[model samples]
Target: MSKVYSTQELIEILAQERRSCMNGQRLNLAASVSGNPVIDRFLKPEGIQKFSAYNDFKAAVHSYQRQHQVSGIIWCELTMKGKTLRYPAIDEQLAALDSDLKILKAAKADLLEFWYTGIQGMDLYLSINFGKDYQKIMPNDVKEVAQKTEWANLYEYKNYNFWEIILQLGWGKPEEASYKRGWPKSGSEYIHAVNPGKCPIC
Candidate 1:
């Protein structure tokens, strides 16, 4: 059976892997190896000798990862690009994510969910199916409200943020929406937000 891990759990696993990578930088090989051939192979003197002098083993490992495109995750399924569909549970979460993405899109943003998980914390704001369909989503009342007023802390409403965008440059808060009721607001703001240094490079 396949294991289902939460995103937070996966993040913790990644952090543990990072700590192990850091520890591997010391290259502390064991004094003795078990009789197992696999263990012996790795414990070979020549194998140790090759990496003995490289203090930055983590960097070398990262370089190897880059060279081979090894993402490390062992996916159980075979490759099936556009043919694959998300699980129902995953689809729900993705829809929620898309709702947040749409809010950011409304404000011309490059921000991700990491900045603000949701209005009341994580997964607290889930106003899925904003409108009748994907093509014409977002209620006219909310859109009209957004157009007339500059709403800040949108994530507080389980929406996304665009305070860092150029349209919001003069805006005091970093969580304000860049647009007021319409798309683009202006290409100039888009340009400023996308410039290398103006926005959060992180």
Candidate 2:
């Protein structure tokens, strides 16, 4: 007989498998269950959508819940790729991003993409892509808030890359977007922007 697992247990199992098999990318639990007869029957295309950004995904989830009277936890697989840092190091970045995201969401920044990229022997970096609405905010304020939010904390021996942040601008999604700023130069050294909110969306 097969061993039964609780919902949380199954989620944990899937997450572990994704880390191992998918090069540290988080498992998209919803997409994983998509097309299953039972799931499709309940959550048809009209009831579910996919978004590359957490803010948009969250807003959609809440809207669906309110309209359908559904009651359940909202869950999504957050992508985290790069060298493994200590648990505290990871937690710190999460906490910082959470704080900053809340502020950005309230400002209606319309985030389009948020992710980390890099791996062992590579420079780990955090990136945020925003829609055109981001331009309403003051550039300096955007820089100040994001820098304090621990924008890049992948490695301990912090340096130029540690202070670097990419601010991408466009509509729909980052990949489909046509605007981005090259790395900025601070003093005499080349560095990326301090935060994405400062980027002008086209």
Q: Residue-wise lDDT of candidate 1 within 103-169, one digit each (tens)?
A: 4334422221212211111111112232111121222333332344321221111114422211111
Task: Predict model 1's lDDT versus the native.
Answer: 0.29
Please write out the lDDT profile of model 2 over residues 1-202, one tens digit for every residue: 6554433443344445434434423323354336679767776342232222232434444354344433322222223344332211111101112333333334323221232232112222223342323223334443454443312221222254343333332122111122332222101111133332233212
Candidate 2: residue 173 Cα off by (Å): 5.4
Steric clashes per prediction: 2, 0
lDDT values for all models = 0.29, 0.31
Any runs in candidate 2 off by more than 4 Å, and if so which? 1-14, 20-162, 173-191, 194-202
lDDT against true structure, model 2: 0.31
What TM-score would candidate 2 get against the native? 0.20
Q: How large an RMSD does model 2 have?
A: 15.4
